[model samples]
Target: MTKLLFIEASPRKENSYSSQVANEFLESYKAANPEDEIERLPLFETELAPLGMEGANQKMENIMKLMTTGSGIEPEGEWAGVMKEIERLKSADKVLLSAPMWNYSIPYRLKHWIDLVVQVGASVMVNEKFEYIGQITDRPLQMILASGSPYENRFPLESDGTKTDFERAYLDHIFRFLGFTDIRLIRVMPTGMPGPQLDEIVANAKKEAKEAAKAF
Candidate 1:
């Protein structure tokens, strides 16, 4: 059976627009692929240890050892936790990320998770020419993003003309760097400004999510 890893980065739970839409997508996906194994990873509940100085040093030491001795040392403590997350990502056939934009970017816990998993000699490699190569490939990644403002087609700049809306851009670039070939996005907008049309907007987003699930 196909293994689908669902990473939830929203802490708002039932009150979160992204989570609501993601739930709809999951329901549809289950109907389309009933035999598929779905694993839910909620960032708020997951015990993701920070890679402090010790963990960082261990990773560098392991990389050096692998390059010279063709074998790396076993990970321990927080480093082992990082390796577990990396292995989980590598084993997944497909991935789904549900997140709400926080200060024009991803949540802190989500970023923490990324830092833990995107490791050299684990999820990526550097060639002799000093070029970076991604190890994980041929997998599809879908992101369900929700934003307080209409950040989707807003020219990717702030009022002062600085770069903005790192939510989609960052995730797309980083995941592609990690070798996700097929990346898809489903967006919900103006979640902070609820109006009379909010219901319709949410309904439409849910409909779009369900349609995407059919082909996912």
Candidate 2:
């Protein structure tokens, strides 16, 4: 049985467009693979350990020890919480993330979770050649993204010269850095549109999500 980690990054719950579409995907996935395990991680409600000065120092110490002694020491204190999250990601066979765009980027809680897990000598490592190497590999990742504005047209660029739509783009890059080779996306856009247009868009996105989940 496959272990699928479903990370919900939006606090809006039932009202969140991204969560709505993600629910469709989950339903389809469950129907298709009844025996598979699905673990829901609600970032907003989760108590994540902050990586303060102590955690930072512990991380560097672990990495340095690994390099010099050929083995890293086990994490302790608040750093142990960070390690637990990293181990959770590593143990999952597949991952699904639902996130709504917040000022053209992902929510702070989601970013905080990412920071806690993506650690050196844990989720990632460095080679002798000074090249960064991702430790987690061969996992399938599916992201459901919702945006208020139509950011696709101006993708990678905004009228004012600053980069736009960092939500999906950042997620893609960061997950890839962690060595996820099979990454897929389901996007719901122009959520700022009023009336039936928004409804239609959401309906279409739900349909797409269901289709994607069948083969996921």
What's the TM for model 2? 0.95
Cα displacement (angstroms), candidate 2, residue 28, comes to 0.3
Model 2 weakest lDDT span, ten residues long: 153-162
In model 1, the runs with Cα more than 4 Å from the true position are 153-163
State the lDDT of candidate 2 residue by residue for 98-166, as single tens digits.
999998799999999999988878788889998878888988999999998876632375463553787
Judge candidate 1 against the unseen true structure and give its global Cα lDDT, from 0 to 1.
0.89
List of clashing residue pairs for candidate 2:
none
lDDT of 1 by residue, 66-153 (tens): 7998777687977898889998998899999999999878999999999998988778887899777899899999899998777654
Clashes of 1: 0
Candidate 1 global TM-score: 0.94
Query: Which candidate number would show the highest lDDT if scored against the true structure?
Result: 2
Task: Score residue 216 of candidate 1 by CA lDDT.
Answer: 96
Would you give me the overall lDDT of model 2? 0.90
